[model samples]
Target: MGELDRAIADYDQIIELNPRGPSVYFYRGIVNARKDDHDRAVADYTQAMQLAHQDQRGSGDRKAQLQGQADDPAYASSADGQSIALASGDGIALRARGGAYAAKGDFDRAIADYDEAIRLNPRDKEAISARGNAYKTKGDFDRAIADYDQAAQLDARDARVYFHRARVYWQMASLAKSLTDLDQAIQLNPKNAYPVLWREIVARRSDQLSEAAKQLDATKWPAPIINLFLGTMTPEQVRSAADDADPVKKKGQVCEANFYVAERALQSGAKEEALKLFDLAAADCPKTFIEKQAADVELGLLRASR
Candidate 1:
């Protein structure tokens, strides 16, 4: 957390030096969002958008002036190049702000920003995938799938795109399709922990528990948390492992530990205990963490079913 604070302080000095610089604001927004300071993130993102628009308008004026001097082909070409670069930068700013809005749970605004970002840069796979996430959060699975498909077509080797698509399939209960996408994602990025974790989860959910166990046992994970999924370590041990000297790391680990314990309780038919554990994970975990998102999803599904 202190590292994030120091980074923000550095961005503050940069902003002070060049108040009109949009990129600094955008980066600061990301750092603030990661720190779970949603309001500050929104403020920085808003500033970034404002400055980016100002830059775009200035670039447009310059391009118009150069067009009036079309006799100078070199001037016109230079203006065109500048305009294209400015447009791309603006698209990036919009996408960054959209992510901040999504983190704040303002899906409508987030989608609007993403739409403009795509319009400005049609081949932006990152923006496409992010828009898909916004649609997924809104329960518009069809649109989410379409966006994910587009992103995959744009960048077939992007493991995150496949992972996002697999998540949507999982939500729709298309377990086989989900598994297929997960397999592709893992094949593309074998060392990525997210795909490995989700693959195990999908396998377990599909009643392929033994297969899940075998796969988990065969693979060496980067995080000790994988032991929880493999059933080699008890939930109590998982919680104990979270007892770290660093408060932030300890909080994150505890959140993950609670989530794994909740999954274990749910698998053992202890719904009440699982719900309690999910509550603890949700309450303690930072919103930026995948564990928090998973816990929220589990809690929502549990309540919906009840």
Candidate 2:
């Protein structure tokens, strides 16, 4: 077992021995969260919070020899001596639960948890980012953008925030702004393929085709992205392009050739090949709006034939 797993097991044992031990529950929750068992983590945090609240109602300073009350002034101030404040652990747990719910596609619940987490700790960037992702999943792009903005401001070093904002911009059809954010994302993490692929696609669709093409060529665009474009090219043209000395350059030419092939197929009743290319393009450039549009066209044709 991992250290986190062992820690969680130890917490379980401690909790079993002392049901009202808020610290034990809190630590267990943290361990469970680290293990990605967010539901159980949430439960542990809630239990810790409840127990913590119950310990806070003492009339005057009274000491509890047990539960490690010596370090807590609030516990010492309580008359019954049973009271202790729940640490920031509850907030941490709520944030974790929100992220887990978001990952599971329960955006509404995730947002609710994030709301509570933010209420407890307003400056929690992780919670804010998780909420933003939930908002994006719900198609509330404006709210997502707002949260992502806050997250970026708070954690400027996080490339993911820029990447997410770029996605929102793309959704809103603010292509230039999207491209800008995508460029930042790529700058921060060159190995990330998403921004590079999407950026290239947006560049292709840009009104200033020559400038966009220049930028794309300068970037040394990936072969898969070039292949996706070439899937739309004409078969003969693709064959001729493949004869080029540089395979990388050939890929771009092939992409253009495939585009023509796919386009001509669509025009000449070769629906099958056209659909295949469309599917290929979508797979290679999922973030491209045009691929989705082409997918819609292919789907429409298929539906009509049925």
Candidate 3:
């Protein structure tokens, strides 16, 4: 928080000097978002979007074009070489604001922003997939599926869209479709054990656990988890195995261990144990992890049932 605040102060200095420049506002918006002040982030992004649009009419400079043109200064600061302006139009600011709106639980505004982002760049698979996730969270499953479908068609090899779509399928109880999407995701990104875990889970839901077990690697970082599901390892062993020399990876592994164990407990009809493990998983897992999201969903469902 200190570092983010310092960055925000630096951005404030820049904005003070160049109040009309959209780039500074755009960067500042991102910093505000990192600080979890999503409403403030939205305001900054809105200003950036307005300035960027104004730049199109030659009121502003070339450095402030939407998503910072090909030579935009914003791209120069990126660690992953991806410009916030992912497309040719005003997609960057829209997507940024959309993300802020989503973080603020304003799904309607988020969806509207995403809609414009998609219109500006139909090939922006990331934005489409994001919109799909928004729709899924809004419980408009059909719209989510449609967006995922478009995203898949736009980029057939993107493993993430398949993985996300599979989760939607799981929620809708379309077990077979979920399994199919998870299988595709696993095949495309074999190193991602989450897809493998989810595939096995969906398979178990469909009573095809034996077939899913056939696909387990049995020799990897998550091998302990696979062995647990296979009944070859105990929960204590899974927890022990989750510990690692690297604290970061260890935290994620432990979280995964708890979540997977919770799944097993649920499968065995041990609702109380499942709830306990899921609570642990939800608290331990990073907010960004799908495991955390699933744990929260499971907790909600279980409590609602009671």
Candidate 4:
């Protein structure tokens, strides 16, 4: 077994021995979350939180011991939110449970958890960013932008926050602001394909597509996508390159191809055709991919316009 698996096994044995041990449940939740088992992770965190709450009204030493469980290195899920992310000592379980809820497409509950987390620790920027993402998915762009603004003020180097804000601007049809945020995102994380891809797109809409090729650097997988935007590769070629031996990864790449191409078509004013491709993207994208959320947003926006 991998280290996380062995750790989980140990935690399982511990849980069997001391079923009421909140620390064991919490640590197991962390291991399970690292394994991408978000459901179990959420359950563990909930149980931990319950036990901690119950023990809080006890003797001074016991209360202190329970409070000591909060630590900066604690994490419940990943940034992609097929889980949660790292947190500081305050309200860790709530921050983590919010992530699990987001990963499960339960934005309202996620937002509630994030609200509590932020109330407990106003400087929890990761939870703030994840909350922004949840708001974005829920079609609450204004609130999403507000949260991202807070997160950026808290940590200017967070590339995904800029990316998230860029998408929000794109949604609002503020293409210039979207391009500006995408520029910041690319400047922060040059190798991230999402911002690079969207920068070309937003630039195209701004009639500045020509200089996009200057930003290109060749790489695997998404290199084909970059080439497609540069006019050096066709849609068919990009799709062909997206084909992979790993079925799960292949699904995401193909979803990206459809979404990007559909976006290009939308920019080119091919509304009906873009709708068809977007449908494919929405149906095919992995649940954890930000593009899947974007695809759903696109579909919603287009349908509302119709």
Find the 10 residues in a row with the least total lDDT in model 3.
74-83
Per-residue CA lDDT of model 1 for 138-228, tens digit only, reads 8899999999999899889988889888988988899899999998987887666667777777777533333434443343322455666
Point out the worst 10-residue segment of candidate 4 by lDDT. 76-85
lDDT of each: 0.72, 0.58, 0.78, 0.76
Worst 10 residues of 1 by lDDT: 76-85
Instruction: Point out the higher-scoring one by lDDT: 3 or 4.
Output: 3
> Which scores higher on lDDT, 1 or 3?
3
**Given candidate 1, what's the lDDT at residue 249?**
64
* Every model's TM-score: 0.78, 0.52, 0.73, 0.77
Q: Give candidate 3's total backbone clashes.
A: 1
User: What's the lDDT for candidate 1?
Assistant: 0.72
Q: Write the per-residue lDDT of candidate 3 for residues 1-306, one digit (tens) a residue.
A: 237777888989988888988878877787677566787889898897787667756533433454335564434332111235366456767777887787677879889988998887788877788788788877799999999999899889989889989998988889889989998997887766668778778777433443455565667778888778778899999999999976656888999999999999999999999999999998888554568778988999999988
Q: Which should have the higher lDDT, number 2 or number 4?
A: 4
The whole-model C-alpha lDDT of candidate 2 against the native structure comes to 0.58
Residue 270 Cα positional deviation in candidate 2, in Å, after optimal superposition: 13
Q: Where does model 1 exceed 4 Å of error?
A: 55-57, 60-87, 205-222, 243-251, 286-290, 300-306
lDDT, candidate 4, 203-255, per-residue tens: 76433333543555677767787777767888888888898876546877899
